[model samples]
Target: MQSSYNFWLVGISFVVATLASYTALDLTGRIYLLASARLRHAWRLGGAAALGVGIWSMHFIAMLAFSLPIPLGYDFATTAYSLGLAIGASYLALHVATHEALTAPRLLAGGTLMGVGIAAMHYTGMAAMQMTPGIDYRPSWFAVSLVIAIGASTAALWLAHTLSNDDARNVLRKRLIAALVMGVAISGMHYAGMAAADFPVGALCGAAKGVNAEWLATSVILFTFAILIVTLMLSRFDARTTFLVGAVSNLNGQIVRLATLDTLTGLPNRATLTERIERAIHSSRRQRSLFAILFMDLDGFKTINDSLGHSVGDEVLSAFAQRLLLCVRSSDTVARLGGDEFVVLSENLGSREDAGALAQGVLDRMRSGMWTDSQPLQVMPSIGIALYPYDGDTVEILLKNADAAMYEAKRAGRSTYRFFERSMSEAATRTLQIQNALHDALAAGHFTLHFQPKFHGNGNSLAGAEALIRLHHPQLGTLTPLEFIPIAERSGQIVQIGYWVVRETCRQIRRWIEQGLPSMKVAVNLSPRQLLQPNLVATMLQIVTDAGVQCEQIMFEITETVAMHDAPRTIEMIREFQASGFEIAIDDFGTGYSSLAYLQRFRVKQLKIDRFFTNGLDEHGAEGSAIVSAIIALAHSLEMDVVAEGVETESQLDMLRSMMCDEMQGFLLGKPLSADDFSEMLRGRMLTT
Candidate 1:
């Protein structure tokens, strides 16, 4: 018997097959991109069902297209069993195709299994016809048919692997082309298998409960299209959903970095540090161990910014942060608490000395120096360590104790580390009290200026006087600079207090000149904080101008340490002061390291020998006067005059005279007296040298 084909039905079969192939490619991409295992497994099962039905519909439809001399039908049970076989084959194919690594061996094995299943399903569907004298198979044609089916499955596997990427650009066009090739292969295998079978003449239908071919084809095609459409839509939706999830995760990471990191150094900021400290406390308590919170400040950082500008200062801070990271353990946390202050949280520390060693290591690194613009800069560190569960059990208390200890280190000449002591807390309390009292004193008009007369070294005439600040507290009584000066400097109260002294000195000078008293130059002590203040010369000039005193009538005295703190900046400020018609005096000389070069560069008018040398001068009369003589000669050689401080003894005065010092300021001739009392002495000539 001769068989014919329905071209329209055959075309529809190819369409269904192509759609299934494209859907298979889409589902592979969706499953591959999913990060959730459960989601991926769900898609895999659903995709298998969709692809299985599509392949089955195409096979059944193609079979229906083949007409014969006898009526065509399929047994219901056999038809259902063939559908199950098609589904099983599709499930295995998807599993192999969407695997992360579709190696050659894997593709070949999966292709063979799927090919065998398709062949069995076709043979099983053919058996659904249940003819009395079953159709016979031609061995050669059947072999060709099996070869075609296996080859089609392998090609489909390769195509699916190549094109199953998530990129949507031109994916549809590429997949459609790929699907056409795949559909043609699937159809070819089916038709070839059908051609291998020969129907005998007068074959009789055997199954009574078989389904009609038209109705089966129609139902399968419609069902297959619906599944394919929904699967493709779900694939697109899942891709977009996962991409959005990844974007949100990236955004959250950025936000966390911003909130917890320093803007300049990229180190953890105070908030992050606080959190870590709390965590460390919990962990250490559990382990019955200790950790340390080191509070550190860079000494003289203000001068660095002032002299080199903030840009270089920022570079220094960043480099300092990197160095801190290098010195600490990976488990430790180093954070910036703003400005030059840094806090290091070292956990699981074995002992207090271990923390001390860590701090000393940091100090040594800083001493080695850092470079910028091909020049090495000197930035020193002062660290204070507060041990957990000892210095403080809470974050606030620990930080407070550490800060107090740090200031003590700074006060102890800086460039060192200090452990927190119970006494430091008391000192901190007193400091707070003094700060409050200072505000009260400034507001309540309790501060006064006392004048100490300095006499010309060779004559009994008043040369100049040093203006000293005196504070008369309600309970502390009259207090000298030694009492509260350091507190003022540390609290930044010196800036304001220094201004008051400046203004009051100018006023006193004007008073002396107006009262027909000697209008000699008066020396005003300048603090390091005052020297670092911007526009200081201009500000003092304005104060002097307002007070109706010449700038020449006021002398500014800075210590040797202040001069050398930032030598370049100090020199520049001194020049500015001198240019504005003010003279600079190196007060308390020999108390700090003063190179000859820096001294010469100072261009000051005089050097005030410190009381240490002056008081010791007459002890041996010659050897005791050696440093005094050298300083006097150095001053003379530099065209600068010399003044002796704290010269109370007549022998000390005699030694200063022999050294040819330009001036002397001590109680030997006159002690510090109230403004009015000093005025009376100026008129009475009681301060005779």
Candidate 2:
């Protein structure tokens, strides 16, 4: 009799095999995505066991689906052995795929081993089926099935490798397609192996009784799908949780960065810098080492901001921050304390020289100039350095001292660095005292003006006088301009003091006029802060109007240093004064960094030679004589009169006169006198003239 097959059983077998294949691939994919090595390894083994169970279930289901001419029963021992073979094969395959690189040669080798194990399991299960007529296989068909198994196994391995390595945007779609392909291939291999088996019709026999085929098929199919659905749902949940946790971590990092860093320059901000400085101090105390805190203020940045606009200023600050970063070590911290102020914290420094060198490097770089899109900008850094244990042991103290030292550097002349000194603190205290006293002095009317006469160089006739300020304190006796003028300037008291001087000078001029004395121009000095006042011109004109004096009778004197500090604004103010019929004089001409080119640009009536040059004229073969001569000539060339200051002796007078100086003022002529004395002298001089 011919053998017969059931097409319905074959269809059922293929569906079960497909489910088993899908379960194996899905579990293996989850194993690959696991983060920890130990967990991944554990999942790998579990996945292998799950797949082994699926494969065993699929084979048993297929056997139960088969309908034969004889009644069949299974040998329990042999059936159990075949199941073991299936599980061992799955473990080996998954281990090889997970542990080794997915190269073609390795994948092929793994596929071959898996194919041999699966083929062995299939035949072993067949041998457990007991019947009177034994089953056989066609040689050609068996070879075909074996070949099919190896080829299908290789394709499944390749699909899994590709899915695992893919990280493209459509990764989910690729994995789905790979799973479907692997499922079909695995099912096809199982069916091809089953097709190779042949059974002859015979009498019914039984070896060991087994469960009914209908019950076995229904139970296995339901159980296998249930396990697979649960595994997939858990894998998806794990992936989503991992993604959320990663996103939260990234957002937290961004928040910290925004809080601690400067938005414009991307450097650490004041709060972060303070924390770092505190930590550095603590560390240094334990290590017995020193470090330096450099306080930097960019010179002329305010001018740039006002002239070029804030946008350009921002770009310049960012560029400067970058350069500042390059000047320090990676271990050091460079922070921005807002608006052109930066602080560098260098810890574990060997000596003061290291700090000095770093400061110098930053200075050189800043002086080289920074460029933006529209123009090149140049700025100077006035750095103040304070060392640990020497300047201060605490954060607040060190920062305070470093700031004091920085201001000292600015006062000494900007574009330089200074270390903190003990005397600066004492000076600072005295400054505070003076600052407090000045407010009271102004309120109490203790300040008075003294007039020093200026003589014409050609003839000793009185030409003009400079109004000098003197303060009579109730407890301090008398304080000269040198003792209190700088305090006023630094404390921003010069504006008030300067207005007093202007008003008093005007009042003195009016008194002289009332005494029938010839009118003479009275020069009054202007502090830098006073010149920068927005209402400066209006204030002076108001004072002159209130004192009943002509603007021509008073001259406002400005030093070259003050004029050059903001040349454009100074020039504008000078022109405004000139238009109001007031005289502008450049005082202490040769002592500052102004070029002759800049000097010629100012609308000035006089250039006073500094006392240094005048005093130097008394020495033998004094180089100052040549300088004085040049200045006088330069002044005349600019259509400005020259005044020689501090001419103590006749020899100095002769030297100045020989240079054709227009005027001279010093003790040799007369000391600065009180308003009454000046009035009396002016009356006598008028009578003599």
Q: Give me the candidate number with maximum lDDT.
A: 1
Give the distance in Å from residue 541's predicted Cα in candidate 1 to where it truly belongs. 4.8
Evaluated at residue 45, the lDDT of candidate 2 is: 69
Over 151-266, each residue of candidate 1 has an lDDT whose tens digit, in order, gives: 88888888887877767678778888988998998888888889999999888667635566677677877887888898888888878888898889988988898799998999
Predicted candidate 2 versus true structure: per-residue lDDT over 227-317, tens digit per residue: 6566667666766776688779889988898889998999999889999999998889999999999998888776677567899999889
TM-score result, candidate 1: 0.68
Runs in model 2 with CA error above 4 Å? Answer: 1-26, 72-77, 100-105, 131-133, 165-167, 201-209, 248-273, 297-326, 335-341, 364-382, 407-416, 422-689
RMSD, one per candidate, in order: 6.8, 8.7
Model 2 earns a TM-score of 0.59
Worst 10 residues of 1 by lDDT: 369-378
